[model samples]
Target: MEALVAITIGTLTAVGLYLTLRLRSFPVILGLTMLSYAVNVFLFASGRLVQNQAPIIGSGETYADPLPQALVLTAIVISFGMTAVIMIMAIGGFLESGHDRVNMAASDPADADQDDAEEGWA
Candidate 1:
C-alpha cells in the first residue's frame, strides 16, 4: 500500500509540474490543483495507512494521528481558495487580452487594439 501511494504521489507531482509549465492558464491551474492533491495525499500518508482501527486515542492500542487529517483539510481549503482566485484572474486576463496564453507578448501592437475594438471596449 505504501509503495502504491508513493507511486501515485510521484505521478501526480510529475503531471502537475508538466502541466504547470504549459503556455496556457487553464493547464497551469490544473497543475497547481494536482500539486495540491499530491501534497494532501502525502500528508495523509504520513499518518500511516490503517483500517479497522480506532480514530482517536482511547483504549485501543493504536490510534490514527488526527494532525495529518486536520492538515489535509486545511490544505484543501487553502487550495480551493487559491484556485478560485487564480481562475478569476485568468478569466479577466483572457477577456481583456482576447487570449488565454499566459505569457502573451506585445510584439504586435495592432492586435491589442483589434481585440479592444472587437469587444466594443475601445
Candidate 2:
C-alpha cells in the first residue's frame, strides 16, 4: 500500500515536471495542478496509512494523525483557487496576445511588426 502511494506520487511529480517545461500556458497550468496534487498526496501519506483507523485518538487503539489530513484539505482549497486564477490569467493573455504561450520570445522582428500592423499600432 505504501509502495503504491509512493509510486503514484513519483509518477505525478514526473509528469508534472515534464508538463511544466512546456511552452504553452494551458500545459503549464495543468503541470502546476499535477504538482500540487502530488504534494497533497505526499502530505496525506505523512499521516500514516493505517486502515480502519479513525482520525481521533482512542484508548489503546491506533489513530491516524489528523494534522496531515487537515493540511491536505487546506492545500486542496488553495490549489483550486490558484488554478482558477492561473486559468483566468491565461485566458486573458491569450485574448490580448492571440497566443497561449507563457514565455514568448522577441526574436522575430517581422512577426512583431506584423502584429503591430494588425493592431493598427505600427
The pairs that clash in candidate 1 are none
lDDT to native, each model: 0.89, 0.88
Q: Which stretches of candidate 2 lie over 4 Å from their true place?
A: 108-122
For candidate 1, the lDDT comes to: 0.89
Position 58, candidate 1: lDDT: 91
lDDT of 1 by residue, 29-106 (tens): 999999999999999999998766767889488888888999999999999999999999999988977889877466
Q: Write the per-residue lDDT of candidate 2 for residues 42-86, one digit (tens) a residue.
A: 999988887877788783379888899899999999999999999
RMSD for all candidates, in order, please: 4.7, 4.2
